[model samples]
Target: MKTKKLVMIPGPTPVVRSIQEQMGRETAAFGDPDFVRDFTSLLDDLKSLWKTTGEVFVVAGTGTLGMEMAVANSLRAGDRALVVSHGYFGDRFSELCSRRGIEVDVLASEWGRIVPLEQIERALASKNYQAITVTHVDTSTGVCAPVAEIGQLLRRFPDTLYIVDGVCATAAEPEYVDDMGIDILLTGSQKAFGVPPGLAILWAGPKALARRASLGTIPDYYIDFDKWLPIMHEPAKYFATPAVNLVWALKEAVRLIKEEGLENRYARHRRTARAMQAALEALGFRVLAEADHRAVTLSNLIYPSGADDAAFRRLLAEEGVMVAGGLAAYAGRMFRLGHMGNIDAHDLVATLAAIERAAVRSGIPVELGAGLAVLQRELVRAAG
Candidate 1:
């Protein structure tokens, strides 16, 4: 039997060997002066990456932790919020609002569809919402929302804080958040950051900070911005026992990103996504998202009629390639291909080839060379 290498499914995307080795170093005490310095530097790097002049908060928790913190600190009981829902994460935000006793007016779009800017404008015009929540990219359906347009609409409601979930959007596509005027942007390390799960980074603009200050009682002790901000600003004191190893890996990842420059990193992601989409379409699989709204990181492709989706995934795994099944409403109907995080044309070609083999093994007759040929054409176009 041949040894199998792991292909990332959705996220906790493949961490590079250099970063992994850094994470394995001997642990340092939380109070060590050097650790505090490194932690502070990481926070600075995070702000630079997000391209925000706001205070960046790093917490030892998952992406949802940042969402919860943003919600708790920004909204008091009886506060009204407008949540734009198009997929799983959007619905999750609505649920979070309900849990926190915040009154919510939800504007929902069909799955795999972008929320209309007109609807968002109407929602803002109709109510005095304290905040508005929108997911920059929906990981479930591979749909990228028009965040900039939404931001423009929010200008009508200038006092309403705009919160964006950039978990799948961050390093994959940074301009959408910063250029769009998102007031609060949050993301986790496991997705585009190429690191293990366990840290969440939140960027809060001045408005978000002001809202936090206005709320007299701290929303939650663990995630209170007031408590964490002073410590983050002080060079000598650290907030929580920082995740030393993960912080080391994050710093290296940010270093690589800075070295590559943001525009080039975004271009790489767009190129890889275009190649994958071209190949899959050539293979007779329909793309779940409309061309204009498709995300740069992952592409959701519908299974061919009469094909068994689960068996197709099993066959691919047997061939040493791993892809993910759809979630919730899309389950058994679609499979997602992730092309983010250090993936390039060569890696995409390999995955497409594996898919070709898997299709044949699953008894679906596929024309040889079609997928790869389409992929090559796109790659050539990208290079030009």
Candidate 2:
């Protein structure tokens, strides 16, 4: 019998069968009546999902496009923006802004740790920035930023637009845009939305919309929020062709999320992450993220001294589990595992068992049942 493969990577997480079925249906025209209804409802449901009254844009692109849409429309070239970076993905904001001729200033924390709020306060005090970008969860280091506190802190600087990169956060994390004062929250469909890639979803608040209006006719055309605005107002209207089937899939994904209840979904992710993290530690694999500042969506785990990163991952794959390798400087030293979306305890139990088998097969000296034992107890504790 062949072992069933499970994609345990940081992104493009395992999509549930119901959501996957939506993607498999016959493709529909972007302007079809039913599609228009579904698209419009998805926009509305996303607003409710994030507790925002902002304009939501579901474009047919990658998460990077969502990031570009933020800086391209909101700020004119030569404007200054501040990037609060916890890891690589957070640091990417600086590059995105810089490419647009925006003067970018980055406050980057050491890998695996988050930048403190006081430092951000000091940065804001020193500069008159047009916008500030923070990654809610940096995919590379698995560090989760205190976005609510950061958003609360931004209230003092009313003129500065607050942009949050929620590519790896979004539905899995508590991102209440109106309450948190987030002007822009951007994410990709592949992560936590429990859908396949190719959609760039973003919610732009009134302030961000105003900022775009203030700086009308930005240089870029593709990601210009103004161009997307008319289409967003009426989903049946077209600017660029929308991903019709993906939109269908996303609507189904949202429906699943709604049925689960946002609070319960968040709690479930927390429990799952806690369980997996504790199990990894028990297996002698240290998490790259700081214990107090870990991301609930995923874990970036550092290898034990004697284990070969490639061999471990290969063995894990042989055991029918797939995960991603580290990026940038941390490459080959760690592996990333996603535990978000509509995953259950059984999935995680199997993953832990795979890891246990992989570790033992690789001569890592971990007791076969140790990680699984810890995972069960930690999950129960986290839940109770």
Candidate 3:
């Protein structure tokens, strides 16, 4: 007999049985009419989820591909691009800009800290940038940036197109893309969308599209937003063969999210994250983020002094529970527990129990009842 496995890591989270079955269905040709209808409907649902009236494009690639498309299409060589770096993904956007020969300026906050609105405004005032990039939520540090505030600041620079990497924010929270004044918004199926990696979704406002057209040079053939956007909007046809199975799974996942109501879905994620944080704090673990700026999808917990982070994770794995270790500068200092899509109160309680068991096995001097008691109280509050 095998014990059940629980996946509490951020991306590629646990999938429901119905969605899994949909993925296992026989693959259909990209040009088929039924597949085209499904694909169009998925795009419409994605637009609704993104809260954007702009044209939406779904690329057959990973989240990074979406970021690359935004960078490649929106900026010409030597164009000034400012990236607000708070965690690993923000750093990646800066790197992409640099690789593309764009003049990149990064206003970096310390890991686990949110980027300040004043700092962004100052950057805009001091430089004539062609585009601005910000991560709506940094998965590495579990911090949520002030996108709406930044949107207001960007209004001061009419020439700068606002680009947001919303990989962890989409579906896990409400993103009013049009109202937030985002010119280029990028996300993927892996994180809050609750599907496997390999599909990227981008919603581009008219300004970004016009900028791409003015460039004259053809963008990267595969990642070109111009090419992909038409195909995604037109009756389904292939620029290259798509990942049909992943498309099917994404369609089903979007259906599930809409059925639950977007606000209700966000509330569920918030409740679960709050419960997990309450439990961790009770167990004497310090949270890495400030309460006001912490992301509701995940929590980053600081390890105790003199504790071996790698060994603690190993101990947890032995008990059949898997959690994520920190990324970049945070490696060896903190652990991350994701409470995003499809995770609920029962799942969080089970995770806390597993953590207690792991703590005891590792001789970490934890109180078995403390974490659970805090979690139970939070669940009760959410129910009311």
Candidate 4:
């Protein structure tokens, strides 16, 4: 039997078996009654997933398209948007806002640190912004922002819409979209949904819909919420051809999530992340984010002083496990491991074991089983 390479990248994480089986099914006709039912069921389940009473959209695109959809629908030229930037994805929100001619004020934090709530407050107080955008988890730096606190603060600015890029945090993280006063919560299907890449999922609250209705002329036709809203509500209605196969897969994915229970899924992600962190630390690897702000979905680890990123990652590949290299400032200097979506303790143990082997192959002296033993210990403790 051929060995299967373990995929541990952040966005396109491992796909669950059920979802993959659904994806393999023959493509259904767009207007077929059964297909419509399944697709609409997916949209309905999204509200439950995001924990929102608002409208949800599962469009055919990546997470970046979801971010653009939020920006294009909520703000127009001359409108002001305050973006809270902690890393790459946060900066992306600011860029999206700026491209639409929306005046953007960015309150940026150190790469590995979340933006302080007080700093966000001060920035909001400085201007009468129409919307505030934040990244729930910045994948680039493994930093989970203080979203709940920021959501609470948005209450003071009632008219301002709250937008969250949950591409890396949704489903895996504990998020209450309705309770957090989130006007728009957007994520991709690939991350915590345990599905393959190609769908942008989002929820829009009443305020955001009203804002869209108030726009003079929509800028982006494909991403315009107004265009997709009717189709989302009535899957039989056509705006653009929905990704039928991906929607079928999403239905299965959502079903699995419901079976697992959101709280249980969140706890599982946390436990697996803890195990990974413990094992990495045991091997003398330094994680980039501070302990308190580290994201549960992924870990950004700095290459040890004597380790080579290229050589280490190559050896890891030879061991039949795949991880990601860092992005932006940390690129080549660090690596990332994604522990979200269908991942469990055993996966971490295998990854750590591979790393231990890779360390030796890269000429870095590591006590055999140092990291693996720590991971197993942590997993046992977590299971209890």
lDDT of 3 by residue, 56-96 (tens): 88778888898998888899788999999888989998889
Every candidate's lDDT: 0.83, 0.89, 0.84, 0.88
Clashing pairs in 2: none
Candidate 4 TM-score to native: 0.97
Backbone clash count for every predicted candidate, in the order shown:
0, 0, 0, 0
How close is every model to the real structure, measured as TM-score? Answer: 0.96, 0.98, 0.97, 0.97
Report the lDDT tens digits of candidate 4 across residue range 212-259: 999957868999887888898899998899999999988888888899
The local lDDT score (0 to 100) that residue 5 gets in candidate 4 is 85
Better of 2 and 3 by TM-score: 2
| Best prediction by lDDT | 2
| lDDT ranking from best candidate downward | 2, 4, 3, 1
Give Cα distance to truth, residue 330, candidate 2, Å. Answer: 1.5
Residue lDDT tens for model 2, 115-203: 89999999999989999999999999999999999999999999999999999998898999999999999999999987999999999
Shift of residue 119 alpha carbon in model 1, Å = 0.8
Rate residue 249 of model 3 by lDDT: 92
Clashes of 4: 0
Model 4 global lDDT (CA atoms, 0 to 1): 0.88
Per-residue lDDT of 303 in model 1: 83
